[model samples]
Target: MSQPKHATPEQARPFLEAFKFFYQINDASANFFMRNTYPISIKKGTMLHKAGDICNHIYFITKGAVRGYVNDNGKEKITWISVENEMVTSIYSYYMQQPSLENMDAIEDCEILSMSHEKLNELYNLEPSVNILVRRILEKYYADAEVRALTSRFSDADTKYEFFLNTYSHLANRIPLTYIASFLGINLETLSRVRAKKRSIKKS
Candidate 1:
């Protein structure tokens, strides 16, 4: 996640729409916990968090995509991508109560609902059902992270790329070539060559 957090200009609409239903937030919980909920929109390539910044909010993407990445010597590497109907956060920093070392960013123009860290925790503590919802959401992130780790170890770059394309087809057309290369653990040049090869075969 990035350092020095800043709030977006508007509330995220699509996110809140889907999320309100996904979590099944009844009138009681909605009135009590998320009364201030609203929409926030971010353009592509916007940094959600910078290195060394504390994560104070959880972003639920209702539209577009989000990714977590790290930068070293001007080179950016993508570690995770969260898309529509998914939750995105700077995990280590948010839970550890420290500054983040990585960065979270938007890959496409996005609508995300930002929920305060403290407020969410308070709701979880007070409501048992809400607590379960929060736990399930966290579990999703954990499981996805594990899948990515396993894929990195057991698959080759081309296989990984193909898997990513087939599985997250919604993302295939929206992402940039550089980020896709980074996600597949292949150099951009290599990815370019592969794309060219595919084009050549299609033409033939």
Candidate 2:
């Protein structure tokens, strides 16, 4: 693992802006968070955290993208992909303080700001507003997870693909098709066929 460098307020601004947009955190609280964060740069294909590793931090992507996946019987099953201005972490491991079941890696060279579990917890205790922000952030993550789970369970392949496109349109051209196929619970051939069909329909 590379050493984490301290983030300057300028580098932390985008992360704070994201929180402010979602949680309405004030400048003072945001500055507190900025002061506590560390900056890290990861190259494409670098695994930030792997299965069986403890997830001690949550990362905010200042730039680039990251994906979460699990190795299932020699196949990589992608769970989620997050891009710039988004947060990524093995929530199960971070919250439970156990070894992670998922692997998180950079899909593109990334600039990230990270906050440790210890500092996050301390912020929760030291700042009442921080607790509200944390709760809302967790709720948002939970809601998104639940929706994705339900969609995968009930939606057809074409419908799933459509949902994937709609939900991750920004990432469509950025991430590999194989990862997107796995995320949508479809095979690569099927995804290709679906794209071909859509293209033909558009031309007609």
Candidate 3:
């Protein structure tokens, strides 16, 4: 993959906004966070972090999308997709300071602001509010992971597809059907049939 381009401060507003919104921090706090951050723009297909790599930073997407997946016996199983204004990180690797089992890659040309784990730790100690924000973010991440796990185990194929559509409506037409199928734990042919059936029902 080609090296990521450097992003200018003017191109970083959305990232700052997202950070403030997600963390519920004030402008001053957000500015402080941004000051310690770096910006990078990656092309589609760029791997942000591969399996077994330590995720040293958390990324705030200003543009484009990212997907997280794990390879299972040569099959790629997608676990999550994040789009513009969202954050992406390997939670286990970031928090535990260990190698990750998941791989994260850019699905579209992406501009992101990133903060290193070391900077995060410094902020946590310097600002009590940051500590609270981090706690809340972790809670949300855990809750979301639990929901995905339970849904995959209990939901039928159609139900899973429906949930995926609702969850990633913005990406329904943007990402490849194959990736979507993998994420929903269905084969490509099944996904095609499901889409055809839906289209037929709507046409009828």
Candidate 4:
């Protein structure tokens, strides 16, 4: 039977455990679902999955941060950033069996728990509850992405800045400034100007 066996501490303060149990794992099948996944320790700036690759795994960030972005020629554009208590993946590739146009990379020395797509399919067949859990995770990802799209398309610069700061408060200080600027869809110089304006207002 599958079980979350003897896992090294991924998080000093985990929201739940390996799978982030939203509820009690009362059935053996549910426990099995949890056990099928394993941990992946990623070095800072390492690529978890690269562009044009089939996304064969789903990653749950147990520690540190991850970002999924796309490249245009040599220019990289950050699209998504996930931190502890979150999951990251090229979901479109995973679900549609297509090549991923984005790359998933670590922003820090990170600990991740991942399950192969085939293994998760097996779990879904053995226990349908596992499918529900996967569905919920997908839902959250879509919802967050949709929010970002809406904000970027409809919101003003100040509004976007406020949302970005509110959503990822510490990210500006943690990640490279260039990545942060890209993630916000702002040019580095523009981001610098905005920061300077904020600091000026604060000093006034």
For TM-score, the strongest prediction is 2
Task: Locate the minimum summed-lDDT window of 10 residues in model 1.
Answer: 4-13
lDDT of 4 by residue, 1-204 (tens): 785543333332353353455433336654554566677688998999999989998877878999989988898988888888887789899888899999988989999878788887887888776666667667777889997786567335566677878877877688887877788787888778878888999999
Q: Write the per-residue lDDT of candidate 2 for residues 1-204, one digit (tens) a residue.
A: 966567888998798778876678767677778788998889999989989999999999998989999999999988888898888899989999999999999988999988999989988777788888888888898998986786588457888877777877887777889988988888999989998998999999
Task: Tell me which of candidates 2 and 3 scores higher on TM-score.
Answer: 2
What range of 10 consecutive residues in model 3 has the weakest lDDT sum? Answer: 3-12
Residue 135, model 1, lDDT: 70
> What ranges in model 4 sit over 4 Å off?
1-24, 154-156
Output the TM-score of candidate 3. 0.89
RMSD of each: 4.8, 1.9, 3.1, 3.7
Q: For model 3, what is the alpha-carbon lDDT of residue 40?
A: 83
Model 1, residue 34: what's the lDDT? 46
Q: Give the range of the ten consecutive residues with the poorest summed lDDT in model 4.
A: 6-15
Candidate with more favorable, higher TM-score: 3 or 4: 3
Estimate TM-scores for all models. Answer: 0.81, 0.94, 0.89, 0.85
C-alpha-based local distance difference test score of model 1: 0.74
Query: Each model's C-alpha lDDT?
Result: 0.74, 0.86, 0.82, 0.76
Q: For model 2, name the residue pairs that clash.
A: none
What lDDT score is found at residue 39 in candidate 3? Answer: 85
